[model samples]
Target: MRPQLHLTAPQNWMNDPNGLIYYQGMYHIFYQHFPYTCEWGTMHWGHAVSRDLIHYEHLPIALYPSKYYDRNGCFSGSAIEYQGKMYLYYTAIRYAKENPEYIHVQYSDDDLIASQAVVISEDGYHFDNRDCKHLVVDVIKDQNLGDVRHTRDPKVWIGHDGYIYMVVGSKVSNGCGYDGEVLFYKSEDGVHFTYQNRFIDSSIGDMWECPDILTIDKQDYMIFSPENIDVAPRPNSNAVIMPVAFDEKTCSLTKLDTYMYLDYGLDFYAPQTFVDEYKNRVMFGWLRMRKPVEGENWCGMLTMPRVLTQKGGHIYQQVHPHIQKLFNQKTNTIDFDEPFLMRISMLENEDVFLGGLHLYIQDDCLWCNREAISIHEDKVCNLTHTPPLNQRYDLEIYYDGQVFEIFINDGYYVLSQIVYKIIKEQTKIKNIELYKLSKIQ
Candidate 1:
């Protein structure tokens, strides 16, 4: 069972999910799993399936590195339906034999077969490593490219031209921790591939990992998570959703608009998305970049699945409505439209408003007796003072979902965060109560 709040795998440390596809009527998710430890170790593809995202059924480990190059592990990659078969193109988790600095590919003999006229397995969920760690995509050294030994995280797709293309994640400047690129390549036949170009730079402030490009509602999107220093319960740099226009002939990404984060939460990253049979652009990603809450015997988590929708060109992700069927709790209502003010007794003679609590001061100035206070009895959340200059800024909000995202000035900025975990859900305002509030505390 998944622990509440933080997501945990059934067995071990899981980084990112690969080979995600729906076959017959089931959804499959594979990830970089090290079953032996709570930490990083030899990589293997872990498997699970769900008719719905909420109820996941675990399966046997999908691919293992039983061969020489891949003996270390099967790192990360993607699964695609090609020529009527399901083919997984991923990185083989191996190090340099001579210098211990190189990386390679691992293959699986159990591929997607088209003759059956099924997506993955029309008969049922069954796959075998037929290739059995055979090298499929190799790291051939080229001038523009650096040490391929640091490459992994392969994303494959059928290009608009009906050919196959893959974008692999790699660390540049050699093995330097956080800098990498989503290296691009193409294959007339899904087997043989040649390097085309580096689509994105590694300097975008986060470890360049799990690069996926998606197009929804007549626009293109490039998805990636930053492995920056300030990870977890805080921004891990911001997960990027940049716009792109892929030139089918050139096979190069023309960077579109500015990059935006998928959510304001700290626990989300390494996301991969797909359009469902119904054409809804749904996405799921590894939740919480760090280890799990102790004693549960598992670490890492996956975010609640959400459908991607665009409004005024910005992609907005909302938790899928259906997940509520699995969830035991529900959010009550709060009036975001009406204004509410309060006055708590000044036990300490000073007032502190959290960036987490969103309070609109639209074009108005608020003066607190003090910037902070530490008493519980009585308080004041009055919206009385207007700015001397009559200028309004975004509302200041100290948020943890259940708490208000106090819209500062007209929703321009709500001082709220999703990176850290809060022990309690917010309750009724002591000094104020506006519209209906249904959320349980």
Candidate 2:
């Protein structure tokens, strides 16, 4: 039950996407990988390349726990093209207990300290961790500024002001407890960085992870995963996007008042974006699995790349054109047992049912329910409610046999679910366009 439209590890475990960039001629995607089992273990950076985003070619492991600073694991980070070389920045992890022999045998836990590090590749494919690893940011010694173990996930980029800017997520150690904040840094060259101020909000969450910065249509936005948020109902964590203003000289971000969830789905988290070859802002996210498959060798998968834009401070996402080209084989009916893509135009008081999933319009809002699916009982959450639809309801749905991704009104809202088995199906009045999707190998 692997995904063909989305990317997964060649075999074992995979998590948050790391080092996503379009460099040289191919687009590269590096991810957090554990090679031993289907479960999480010590981390390494798995590498893959694709000329077109639909198909991929797996490469060697890019970064591993080689140096003393990152001996425990190599956590998540980003990549950039600097001076004709590929600079890959990542969070290097080291544990308090000294057990070098069991690094690959044990799963990472709370007894770890993290620092930011970099590895350069003269070419896009070769990464020599033994000789190329350099520790750029050391572990914090002062507990008042940030938690020593939780400061990590360096996202580096070259700003329009001709300087390299980096954002690392952390938990600020307040007198009472901790607050979520993002640490900023600046550099003339990509190697060495100087500390700058941080952006914090007491109401955001207790901690943040995998912070990303991007500018769309002259507007700046920060995307991050907030942990242990003070909310009635939540998943393991949540991904949010907020509009912000950046100071190039000070390397700081000013957060705006309102923020929105990046995805209203139970299986989405840790989204990272990069500029495509055509300069389109593209995003990829980890589909967080609530429970591991009983006998499968792989555990996690990524979401389909979404092209992003903004209007009135709200981010809009849509399926990439490259993915749309694969669904050229049109059909009159869709089979839930196979991979397929379907689009429908929904009207007020209209309800559409595809297999076990249901979509309906109620009180001018778009709603989705997956409670009828067999895997609904195994999920963290199974219902989605969108804000007012303004009477426009165009829906696009993709089912890769194991996962179902629904896009409402060209991505104004999205809900993704994992469906193991489709029990029943009932279709309403339909003017539908259904197509078969090509396999990705």
Candidate 3:
């Protein structure tokens, strides 16, 4: 079953989220969608909007593979509002007959893909892609800028100096291994861009995708999803958050501390953030690379909108307050059959043990043998963390149909998955307040 509160395409495959913004009293989100089939194919920009982040209304496709600049696909990117108009900077893909020289060094003669383009809209709902003349950036011929074939995913924003800045993900070779790099560009006008600087070279993963920057309390934070990195207890394609200090004088970023995973789970990736109408940093992530359901026709879902805050040098995430307003009634007893909100906490001087819980398939029955754990079917994804002896551990769970989103200690850790197997018995949890969520109209 599809998620009730989360955003997903009505049909077909969806992947990385792109172009998140708020304009004209509505929150708009765009994503990589293949509408023709359930499998990954030609990508298009699937659009949606919501007054409140909890309930969404799907709109028409914003961008498609119509022009030569983006004939291959419309990949990931970001959006900005300029002079009451909406501008979308996206990775427009086009295949070439001959492979680039850089691709021949590391890959065979078969791998060659390039993307760089921008589209504008007078109204936020419609975009212009009739001609390829709207192209702002072209294929890079500079060898020092890294592999041009691998350069994509443009993230653009306006700096305090009123100059527009863009960051694009690319790959650079370091004699022994290929390292991920993000090339920077600056434009006096939002369309024409000039090369600035490159950052996060060879220190992170081999390839970075969907790069973004968020500023909170005058502190800069860089976010991106890296590939080919070994991250235990989580997927290798994980999003990372690094605290960075931006030097306006030099137009560069200095790493202030080490990077950490944004979510310690299997389903989160390609997260993007935007300032909402309430002036809060709201973030949404694509729930990708998960096990497919047996008979489901649709795939991919977005994580619940989370408000980000930095406290004591750590970034904290919590469910947006607009979502909490959907909880209409509260009760003390658990209802295992319906969609609900659950909050669990440990008592004083007590440790909540989770090791004894066992969820498995036996005799074709979906069984959850432990009181603290809940199970529906084959998906038994859970976060592994030790609780302090005398400290309290809080867990907030949103159960909507077969989807379960677990937020531990106010989102210091999060676990989410879609359970496909059927539930054979009832399960209960203690020290939890159960609230029945009113279904969205």
Candidate 4:
């Protein structure tokens, strides 16, 4: 079967996807999935893959919490292809009796296409929990790796310094403020790692879940999603992507100037990357909304993977251009220069909120309305001016796909919202007027 993803299985949980490994022409993606209902409970690793990362097929559950170490739930982690074999390192959990979390390592050699491999690892070799399901670094423990609630999502990457490094999502000493950072460590061998630095810490969001690093043409990029829920109107999923540069001088990481949306639409996060057969840096953003629409059974899905590019130190992600063919519907050319009404027909209603209009002056202008961002917020931003580019913004309205996202000024500012089940065609939105336009690219 060319595996397909359905709505979130009846459940209360599912946040991050951990192990993303590409092998022998096949990309294996495992995520945190809960079989129960909309709220988050017993977690398992949901599996899926694709050759092109465009069309995906979902396989059965991959790693269950059936073992003692992972009896509670299996959390986030990452995958690496080292020494001709595939290895997975993830966080396994427990509730009360022994709630402390730890890392679990597993590997595979012979037959590949597996839903769940019982042949885990002992020293990461074909046996489950050979020691304690975790490879702990004793000397590094004093770094004050606080919180018994710690441990989940380990991201490994090879650095420019000719050594492999891994960053785990961890809290700071004493759990003082809301500080979550990507703890760095170095290792000659992919298995036993040595502590490095704080990598990068914003101390901003509630808890940092998945931390994955990507380097393109010599520049390093760190990607992560926070558990912060401060949306206007209501709260939903909070997925953010920031630019991080590694400072060779201090051997640390620094945040770049701007921040962009991971996925402007709903249900998106836990992104992981890999250089495909063509060696192009590609990423997969899981499209699993924290809160599914009212009656929708499934709560999770993954977006078509995208390619990453950097210009002038800024990183931009575009749906791998090849998938443009997936639009499937032929586009219609329409024009509505000057102010006009969309859905809201009446003259007064169609009117732009005057000076409220904002312009994405350049082809790559990115601005954020912190006030406009919160978990489950119903936000409506009105713009009175068109972009500097005189071209009308051609939009693809996936209405029947009740999900609503607005990409204005050539996708400069993405505005996405959740619209309840209503008549798709009768969106009431008809004329889309252009108040102004610019020639800027």
Candidate 5:
């Protein structure tokens, strides 16, 4: 089913969001895409833009596999504006020469070498990846600092000390296997970069991807994706948010607080954030899917842009104000006949069933169980939760037929997931404000 309020690719496969930024009065989102099929393949950067962050227009591909250094794929990265130009930095993949038969769906340690590069666009809509692309970091020569095949996903920004700083997801040898870490790079200019130091933590899993650093309420935090780590109640790769201490002079990061799952749902990963026009750190993430929904050619969707805030050392994600404006028309009941939004309050032990999805409050936690719909034989689909809740809490739910984005207690906790269909709903919320969301044109 086509989503009513979320951003999906024009067609085919899309994964991690790349090069998210607000530039020249427009919000540009570049994503990792494989255009020819509904399944993942050789990666290319697909482009889209919106003036108000609610409605988007698709553009031509921004970056692809062209040069020898990046012939295999153009992977995930971030965007920044420098000197009247937009600088898009991404990981460039080049497999070994003997691996001519390499398939992207298969994983092999000996199959690839990864590096970093940047492409500059004078105008936000136009990109010249062939002639303008420059190699900024080479993994082949810096193998001591990171694993040659795993170093990627460069997130760059200017520091308070007036130096261009970068954090790239990397892996360093721990004798038996590799441990995830982040490599810091210092640059006088945005293009030329030198490796300064690396940040390593034992809890950071086997490898990390899509590393992002942002300050909220004067506190720094790192957002990233890690593989092979088991978060409680879930046993796969997931997005993580952790409070950190960044040293501007040394260009390094130190962990300050424990990490938490960014979204407590199955279909979220590789999120990246950008400073919006309003100066809020807004984020978007790939709502991952195993396949196209039966007949559709597109297989992925993006979460509604979330404005992040911090309180008591924990990050909270609220729906962007532009999204709030779309649901201005008020209604009376919650229905899936079309997209809708609802705000309600529930006390402890209260349970509500919206067709196949089950929401309940128990054990001081708000839980969303969706096993009754869209069952997968290999994986359990009912594993969604929020952080511990108070005796009473408010919820804001945006239901777009097949997908749901739930914000708890004004986004102190968020849970986003996809369910195929809800045939019926139970439990009526009294004195609640339910609104019919405006359809995207």
Candidate 6:
């Protein structure tokens, strides 16, 4: 079952939200899309726009693999408005005709990929490569830049210093082994980027992808999904947040010892953020499914937009205010057969046990046990720990079709998953209030 409100490609495979920006009174979102199949293949930048975050209209394919520099695919990147023009900085991928030695020798010639390019648009809808030369940044052979094969996913932003800064994900060889590093670049104009330095080298993972920098309350935070991390209870790919302090004069980042997981869930990754007209740091992520839906034509979805804030040395995420307008107040009890929004909280001086496929808290953790309704052999259940609650705990759940999004304590922690089962029995929750979602036009 596809989502009713969450943004998904009309058809085919989609992943990694790219080139997110708000310009000219519209929110433009581009993503990694494969139009021909339900499986991953040649990637193109799929386009969509929304006047409000909740209602989206799919636009034409934004960027295709046409140029020699990006003939293979138009990979993930970010967008920025410069001089009344919107510029998209993307990793243009083209397979090498011959295998590069730095890449593993076992890889086939067709498997070798290179990332390099930028495109521009005047009206925020139409984009072309003619404005600037394609492949603005070429693959580097320098040992310090690490394995060129792993470099990609360019995220660019205009800094407080009024210079455009770009962070490209790459792997660095530190003699003994390769580690993930984010290479930094600067430009006075949107084009002609100059390599400044590598911003971060982390021992947490071997490669980093989808690097993003968010400046919150004068603190620069670097966020990325690292691959090959051996941490227990971690997904194959997970997003991490590193607190960094940036020096505009020198254009460098000093990473603090503190870092944390962006989301403690299985389905969240490759998030991109944009500053809204309200000056809020809004974020969205590709909600990754571990396995394909049995009968679906489309294969990916994005999480609901969240506003991010930092306080007391912790990052806080809350649902964007725009989304609350979609809540229908006609009902207070959920109808299991249809899409609904449910808010639950513990009763005063009361302990309650929710039954029949409902979420509940236990031992300082939020748990979802769907074994009662699950059709698959593998149990559909998960738990994420949160700070101990002295009183009632708050949870908001949005059930749209087969997907369920759980926001705990006003989004301090979130859990999103797809469940295929239909509840056959009545479920009860403490002080629950249910509302239907307004139908999307």
Off by over 4 Å in 4: 1-14, 36-38, 98-143, 160-162, 173-176, 200-203, 229-237, 247-251, 264-267, 288-296, 328-413, 416-420, 428-441
What is candidate 6's lDDT per residue for 219-334, written digit by digit as tens? 78988888876444445567778888877667677888666767655557899999998999999999775445677778788888889998876677877888866776658656
Candidate 2 local lDDT, 1-441, one digit each (tens): 677778988988899999999998899999999877777778999999999888898998988889999987999999999999999999998888756666554334457788999999999799998999898988987776777889989999998888998999999867777789999988888889888888888888878999998899999899999887634444757888889998777877888657777777657888999999999999999987655566677778889899998877678898888997888888876766667888888888888887867888988887777777635333367777677889998888898857888888878878787765575446453898899876544
Per residue, candidate 5 scores C-alpha lDDT tens digits across 1-441 of 688668889999999999999988989999999998988887999999998888789999999888998988998899989888999999999777544464554355666689899999899788897799999998655556788888899999988777889999887778888789999898988889988888998677889989998899999899999887665446478899999998878877899878888888757899999999999999999888777777687888889899999888778899899888889888776667788888878778887767677788888888888877755644434666776786657889888857888888888878887876575754445657788977666
TM-score between model 5 and native: 0.94
Sorted by lDDT, highest first, which candidate order results? 5, 2, 6, 3, 1, 4
lDDT of 4 by residue, 323-394 (tens): 534434332322222111122112321322111212132342222222222133343222212223243443
| CA deviation > 4 Å runs, candidate 6 | 97-110, 129-133, 230-234, 290-292, 328-330, 346-360, 370-392, 424-426, 439-441
Work out the TM-score per prediction. 0.68, 0.93, 0.86, 0.68, 0.94, 0.88
Kindly list the per-residue Cα lDDT of model 1 for residues 1-441, writing each as its tens digit.
233322346876887767777655667777778887777666777888777665677888777666555656666677777655667666664444422343222232111110000113223345555442345466545524643455666788888887788776654553444464667777787776777777646547534667887888888778876556343334445466888887656767877776655644333567788655566787777654344433546666665556777777767665455543333322333333321222222222234333223222333443322112211112212122322323543232322222222333332221222222222233233333223212322
> What TM-score, to 2 decimals, does candidate 1 have?
0.68
Worst-scoring 10-residue span by lDDT in model 3: 102-111
- Top candidate on TM-score is 5
Q: In model 3, where do residues sit more than 4 Å from their true spots?
A: 97-110, 231-234, 289-292, 332-337, 346-391, 422-426, 439-441
Worst 10 residues of 6 by lDDT: 101-110
Better of 2 and 3 by TM-score: 2
lDDT for each candidate structure: 0.53, 0.84, 0.73, 0.50, 0.84, 0.75
